[model samples]
Target: MGEPEAARAEAALTTYEDDKLKFKVQYPSDWTTSTGETPASEEILGGGARDLFTISPPGANARDVNVTIVATPAGADFTKMGSLGDAYGFGYGLVVPLNKPRAKKGQEDRIQFAELIDSVGKGDYYKVEYKFAKPSTGINSIFFVLAGLGYDGRVSHLYTATAQYPRAEEDKWRAQVEAIIDSVVYPPTIYG
Candidate 1:
């Protein structure tokens, strides 16, 4: 007989903690996640980053809405890393370049919105929202990246949520995605 299939993530909502990145975030149980260590030909999946986890809804493809968590190297300042404004700027600077190419033809306008939000126990995190249609498929999609520092103060974990669906269904999934972003909890940082 074949081995039993693994259980799916909870349908209601659940938390995911990355021991290596030292951060935690809540996601829908139905969404599936694949660790960065998953065997792949590329070292960095996107934005020259490492330690990533790709979260996707059932039967979704690359053009559909998905979420990715990435760990990035941090500078010496822990407080700055925790500050939402600073992190927002840092994150914006890092992602714009990577996303430029994905912008829709002629509409490659780089439009974005960002804000600072308070984390329950952690200091703060930056939330950014942006969107563009793929030039090839002409699929309009949106992405949200919640960025904050990890417990070690030496790394920043960015929770990137993305979605692409029919315009009529946007409201339903947009609210769902925002809720998931709000449920994030960062690991405790330890100073030397």
Candidate 2:
């Protein structure tokens, strides 16, 4: 990891505490926040993206838009995961230019530090979710994965969070989103 970083963000005008903060990063000021929940009908893997949730906070409708980071490993063979027999999933992705890699090996798992900056390259805010597709130990059985750029450069991770609100209510919460995501960073010590 180049720089160890963490962030606090809000999406879809909804709020949540540090219930389970796996990791955090600061985003640019332009990138918005997003939120969503896992569908009940979805299957359980390693706890990754299986749905796409979007919002403009809980009140406004422009500028600030929070996303549900629902991503899974591209290399994952759904068939390999097991029967895809009626499984539900959700996730979202943004086209971003990845910076130079600091790792000596491949760019895959080596991307220890990653985040979504602003459109103008400024530090913005973003909501992220890191789930490794496996069996969950929660009340229900869950399976999600954090696969990287498979043969194709699809989404590296699926950031799934809860923004359980409508588009028009995410006003004030929207303004603070970019700043939060922009602050995404990884601890340098951990990288070493």
Candidate 3:
């Protein structure tokens, strides 16, 4: 038997390129794109991210359904960590503290589930799936993330792409979201 038609068919996709960062990715053709520096809230995390690229669904805000890529300098500490799991742990550690203070009233924002889905090229890249919930806001979002390490000649960097959407819409958007994350392409000359 052959692969399912749905799997074989490709969706309309548009490419987003960062000439300065030497990276590019393909997203849904109808999605909107934006670029900016890391927000101040993220600046405390190990000197902060160097750049951010966001892709949001048509007529939707990033908080609703989006894919975000954060590029940050991978210092000695990150290089020393040595594994995809460790990298993920390091990033998650930074996020938890930030979310703690934002929790509503008596409710806590927490990770309902997390899994290290896969890795490629001996830890050059990794994929993860996790569920986070803000009980007070009644929001349960599912996240699909891809993290990779690259060296941009002068410095090493970590590029993480996160795709998030409400859990209730998973059945409708999971495949497309996964496709977007999987389509990410880093500079061939920079990444090993």
| Residue pairs with backbone overlap in model 3 | none
lDDT of 1 by residue, 1-192 (tens): 654443333346768877676667677787788876433346454344456766667765634766666665544464445444554465566455654443456665543332222222224556666554444454565556666665544554333333334334577577766677666666544441
Which one is best on TM-score? 3
Tell me the whole-model lDDT of each prediction, alpha carbons only: 0.56, 0.30, 0.69
RMSD (CA, angstroms), candidate 1: 8.2
TM-scores of the models, in the given order?
0.61, 0.25, 0.71
Instruction: Tell me the tens digit of each residue's lDDT in model 3 across 33-139.
Output: 88899654544444754788899888665686899988887764555224435655655653454344343555454423333333333245666676666665666
| Tens-digit per-residue lDDT, 69-150, candidate 2 | 3334333433221122111111223212222235465544434322232222111112333221111211111111221111
Each candidate's number of clashing pairs is 4, 70, 0
Order the numbered candidates by TM-score, best leading: 3, 1, 2
In model 1, what is the error at residue 166, expressed in angstroms? 6.3
Q: What lDDT is reached at residue 104 by model 1? A: 55
* Candidate with better lDDT, 1 vs 3: 3
Give, for candidate 3, the lowest lDDT window spanning 10 residues.
Answer: 111-120
